[model samples]
Target: MKNMNQLITIAFFVLSTNFFAQDKQDQQNEIVAVWITADETKIEIYKEGNVYLGNPINSKGERNTKIEVLNLEYTNGKWVGKIYSKKRGKLLDVECLVEGDNLLLEVTTRFISTELEWNRAKS
Candidate 1:
């Protein structure tokens, strides 16, 4: 009876761990899609290995060309990363969250922090 109870406990622990890991993966994948900024710039967000990256697909300025605007990794139940600021001419700390059809990105710097919203592009 003791051995059987121990086996059941171990099995439950393993199953619960697997379930939570899978759930986190699903949450992380939700950000993988094309998002459009308020200025109508299209950014494609994709996963490369364990990290998520975003790049602009369509923009007129040379600054927006062939640059990784976003580099994110999931940690502590949030997506933490750095985003390239074209205006600031550098990369800044960014946190990303998906709320409904909007992707909220908070960019922080030494002096100020601001949030930008990007809408998920329709397929």
Candidate 2:
């Protein structure tokens, strides 16, 4: 009887862990929209099929800039992707997290690390 109870406890823990992970994934998946940074830079985030992308827009709402975020995939509780730097003309690895009303992005490279905070834009 004690062994049976232990087995049931282990099963419950596994199920609950999966449930919470799925919940977090669902929340992260809902980040398909436009967001504004603290410096008023406008970025439009969208998903094309399974690929998540981001582009910067100008005052005229034209996506004339190069893609900012590309090939984003939700994995291990965060969005892992690549960000294109127009100034440097290079690609950098990026990780994104949606925290409360903010989207936190971290960009990393061999010698540089950048963190950006963005809020969902109001339509």
Please, what are the lDDT tens digits per residue for candidate 1 over residues 51-100? 99888885452234468999999887678999999998999999999998
In candidate 1, residue 81 scores what lDDT?
90
lDDT, candidate 1, residue 5?
100
Among all candidates shown, the one with the greatest lDDT? 1
Clashes counted in candidate 1 amount to 0
The digit string of per-residue lDDT tens for model 2 on 1-123 reads 999999999999999999998987677677777888777888888777777888888889876446564568877678898977666789888899888768898989887889988999887
> Which number leads on TM-score?
1
lDDT of each: 0.89, 0.81
Instruction: Pick out the ten consecutive residues of candidate 1 with the lowest summed lDDT.
Output: 58-67
| TM-scores, each model vs. reference | 0.83, 0.68
Model 1 residue 80 CA deviation (Å) reads: 1.7
